[model samples]
Every structure is written in C-alpha cells, then in structure tokens.
Target: MPAITPEQRVLDNLRDTLQAYVAGDVAATAVVTVFRGQAPALALPEAFQRVLDELLRRLEMADVFSQDSCSFSSTGIQEQLGVWLDKAEARVSARTA
Candidate 1:
C-alpha cells in the first residue's frame, strides 16, 4: 500500500467534504467549518484563498442559510469546486516538480 502525502490527504478530504455538502449531508457544515479553520495554515496564495473563500461562502449559504427556507442546488457549488480542484492540482504538480 502506498502512503498518502499530506497534500493528497487534504485534497481527498476536500473532495469528500464537497461531495457531502452537495448531497445534503448533515455533517457538511461542521466539516467545512473545520476545513476553513485550518485554511490559514495551508499556505495558499491570496488569489486562491479569495476564490476558495467565495466558494466556501456559497456552500455555507446554500447549506446553512437556506436549509429551512429553500432547496439548495449543487450546480454552482460543483462548478466552483471544479475550479478550485483544478487550481489545487496545478499547485500540487508545481510543488512536486
């Protein structure tokens, strides 16, 4: 079995958390909250962080703010997630090279 790198672990966690959020899992908020709590230490560039912050805010708004009032659509969330993942993968590739 191959050992997972910290970067891969983080990415995997993010992917799983995003999937949970999209699926309306009850624990999504807590997971995202914890992830955001550790975001500062991730050493992400300001631009990347800004985009990610927006994505997080959208996810929170969809999941928490409208939980009782309206149904949350995962379309926008998935798009933002794709963007973030692409960028993160690029950064990982650069770092590994």
Candidate 2:
C-alpha cells in the first residue's frame, strides 16, 4: 500500500470525526444537510470559501457563498453572519478531526 498523503490524512480525519453518524456503512447526507442548513449567507474569505465549497460539494449542494451570492440576501443579515461563524468553527472541526 502507498503511504498516505497529508491531504488524505485530513480527509481520513474528517471521515472519522463524522464516522459515528455514518453507522452501518452509510454516508453522512443527513448530517451534511444539518450543517448546510446552519451555514450562513456571507461573502466568505478565500480559505473559508474553499472549506464551505468542499462541504457543499461533499453534501452534493450548490450553495457556495461568495460576494455575488452574498449580495442576494435581503433580510436577517446579522443572523447570517452569526451562522457563518458557526460554519467557520464547523469547518475547523471537520478538518482538524
């Protein structure tokens, strides 16, 4: 077997962190949905954007937020920012796991 790369190690950690939720050889679709629902509508920093995009990509959704996307929201702006903070923390946990 080939040695694991750093990126693979990171993904392994992510899979492991959410592994409990993926019982009986399942994917984490429901969990991803929960996380995405909590993610906010904001113009993410590049690093944050990539994490959110990957989270969405894994979740099979297309709701990546950028400046253009952020512009479309009209209400509850502060709530959105708060959710982004939650998402950022979630992103950290997902990676560091």
Compose the digit string of candidate 1's lDDT tens values, residues 1-97. 7676777777777777767766767364665685586555456789878887877666677666654343444466666776787778678758866
Clashing pairs in 1: none
lDDT of 2 by residue, 50-86 (tens): 6655644533332234312544331233234335446
Off by over 4 Å in 1: 1-3, 67-74
Clashes of 2: 0
- Deviating ranges (above 4 Å) for candidate 2: 1-27, 41-46, 59-87, 90-97
Q: What is the lDDT of residue 69 in candidate 2?
A: 51
> lDDT of candidate 2 vs native?
0.44
